[model samples]
Target: MTTNAQQQLQRYLRNARYEVLPLRGVVEQVRELPAGTTVTVTSSPAKGTEATLDTAARLRDEGMHVVPHLAARLVRDSAHLSDLLARVSDLGLTEVFVIAGDAERPAGRFTDALSLLRGMEEIGTRPYRLGITGYPEQHAFIPDRMTIQATDEKARYADYIVSQICYDPNTIASWVKSMRARGVELPVYIGAPGSIDPSKLLRISMKIGLGQSMRFLRKQHGVVTKLLTRYTPENVFDELSPCLVDPDYNIAGWHLFTFNEISKTRQWAIEMADRLQEVPA
Candidate 1:
């Protein structure tokens, strides 16, 4: 018989969202995913918000449920925000993820996710579903107290929270527990790295300032050696699966950071889902 944990894991895998970048050949790779998959388009300082929206629009046209990131630092002002919101409304998109962005300086009035969220409310053009970022591990620049406070404040306007990618299951579970203790009731979607090259993953993780998570990986016996080959989230998932059945955690599902390795990640998700189904219920 399938255990409760197994059933939850299966359901999470089936409904997981795939996060993709707005880069070359991404659309083609996304086409390989199952029909109506939720595809999140990321915004970056280099590519700008237009790239993210354009990619999202294309994917939506191809019949995928697309959620584009709106980087606060990149938005020029209220006019720009209105224009972007209009475009999104035109596309009939009901969801979006807002981030403070990686840009060194704010382009205009909005400097953080909270301000942008308020700005959206002021203009009366907010999406039906808004996602805000959460950090399980301490951020490189933002202090822990501030991160927690900001999350508590943003929770009022957001429909959900998507945590930053963290490899340690204990840390993730503890963070979720803490969120509940603090009364932030938004459903969380755990951010996880998809099946990808270990070396590349490490480099990207470092670049994105996942210092504590990187340290945790280094402490694992033989984990660094495994970096020469491929890496998977099986260990993390196995350790975290039990939490999926816990009501207080309210972990809605996984948000796989495919990093544009859609083919490999999609295959991994499919195989895992299949394996879960094979267990007798």
Candidate 2:
């Protein structure tokens, strides 16, 4: 029923979900990637949805399985949502990652991610897979209880949860357990840093209000702030290893906050996974 090669390939897939923040020439980043690895291109409320959909379509042409973040804050109305979904269908895209998105003020009727998810369901735009963010640590702006409520509501629509990158593996393990206790059974993609310029990553994390990931930065303030630190997936593995090796946890894979640092992160992961194989597995 199983082969070592098959199992190792599955593990590699388990550890690869690239988080693409919209920045200078992200399309180039997408075009250069190894085929078959999932890439999620996130759109902020500030970034226009048309721009995102267009980019998604282009990446689809390149044969990347791009899951575009349809930021609810940016969409204007049902008509706009319809157009967006139509684009996805036209591109043959199957997955979407929905987020409430950060807009200083709502540009349209949809206020949060759940509303958009509901709209998608109502409009008959049911994607094959939908992903939502999970906060292992507290959200800075959204109160903890509200965060739980929001996630619960989204669980009805989303297929899986991707965490805001947290450095502590113990925290990740505990949070996953907590989520299960709270009855959120959707599988999770553990968020983590991928050996990039830690300061840039921290700045971006704080800017995005990435909840626990920001706190993770503050936790390492003394050392991180001064030096140009590089945080690798090892921090995540410390907690994730137990789950990855266990059956109960069902820790699906990794969601890397590439911060558009794809070359460095991807290389690091390839090398790390290779090294793991050599360590007497």
Candidate 3:
């Protein structure tokens, strides 16, 4: 029998959730989402954080809830930080997600997420809500202990935690347990991939350097390879169902990494919601 927690998890996913990179056609794609739907824009080393904020501004203008990723290593200094803040303020942005970024080297004094969080405090125009990244599985380059320490340190400044893309439910559940054990209690938005074909999925995975996860997925050759064929979060949602309802887990919702496959992903979410509605939830 599915538990009530599982049901809530399924229902939560039915609500609009999208994570988009700053790419071509994204604005048009986001326009199709319902008003006030949550949309997070990602920062890319190649395209820069400006692209993220610009996309967020357009979404905000269109009446959507926009959250821009503020990559720490990308900010040059306090002046740059203030300019970025001013832009978001002008756009009426209320939330932001902070990360250490994937840059090979820091662009300025801020080398990590905590530094950027502190800079926001000093600037005194911080967003109403702040988010930090969490990794259920080990990060490709950072040690697990370092990742844990970073999460713990940044938890105080964050309103919520959006986990990095993780394919294993067991790993996610276990990570939640570990978080609680270590006293990190922010609400978590579990990350899942949107419907993406193999070629595109591999491209984004490589672009983001998700080495450890790609390796893990590759070990399950049939399933991992098929992820290239037609990707959906059906199995992922099912596996995460129990965790959502568990009193011990502070799971808030889902964060769908759409990878620019916005239209198809939205359709999949709608169909999944309808299917869940027909079931005994």
Candidate 4:
């Protein structure tokens, strides 16, 4: 007989996106992962888009479902965009994460996520799934209205929205309701920081563009921020737990920002899933 815990894990495992940091241990971690793992590799706009493409290829060769992050600012023109699509197709990559990457300046012509999304569609690149970032907290550069509009625009081509990390559950829950009210009906995969280390989590957040959320961490002495590394869904699920009993929010599952501390993140997830089992759901 299948245990309730196992059943829950199976259900979540079916659709969850495992965000793999493109670090030294990624290939090793992917090699040992089970078949169901669909890994999304996020890259820096400053680092160059090809790195993300290469990471996805490596993950694909390891027989994992790989989703590459295509930072909008990094994509130059139609030819560069087409080349990426062709490369992705050749690598058997079926999903991609589109973001207005954290770059001091655009490498070329593209400026934002919507522009890149439009380019991909016009270029005829149809991945099985496309994901865009959602910010619950105040965005650093853009206003909230523009952020919502951006989501709406990208929602046309993207299959899902992966939320940026927000410490407050109320912000997330409220954001989800607000998103639906606006008719941006893409399925949402909540981005929860995976268990790693406090200091590392702080460094990682700033490195990957947490923006205003970083200020909160600074004020809190990195208390809430530490959860990004020291705990997995346990911290986030606590915030979203009410949704499990009654689906108030459209959170499909979680997109763990496992900052390449794969083993610790994996262990925390396994433990949390097991703990959720005893809850008698």
lDDT of 1 by residue, 202-246 (tens): 788878888888777777745653642545877788788778768
* Candidate 4 lDDT, 173-204, residue by residue in tens: 88888988988777788787777677777776
Give the TM-score of each candidate.
0.95, 0.89, 0.92, 0.87
Off by over 4 Å in 4: 1-10, 13-15, 206-232, 244-248
Lowest summed lDDT over 10 consecutive residues: which window, candidate 4?
Answer: 1-10
lDDT of 3 by residue, 168-194 (tens): 778889998999999999999988888
Once superposed on the true structure, which residue ranges of model 2 sit more than 4 Å away at CA?
A: 1-10, 13-15, 209-221, 226-230
Number of the top TM-score candidate = 1
Location of the lowest summed lDDT over 10 successive residues in candidate 2: 1-10
**Where in model 1 is the C-alpha error above 4 Å?**
1-4, 222-230
Candidate 4 clashing pairs, residues 3+ apart or interchain: 195-229, 196-229
Model 3, residue 32: what's the lDDT? 79
Clashes of each: 0, 0, 2, 2
lDDT of each: 0.89, 0.76, 0.84, 0.74
Clash pairs detected, candidate 2: none
- Output the better candidate (3/4) by lDDT: 3
**Which candidate's lDDT is highest?**
1
Give per-residue lDDT, candidate 4, residue 52: 81
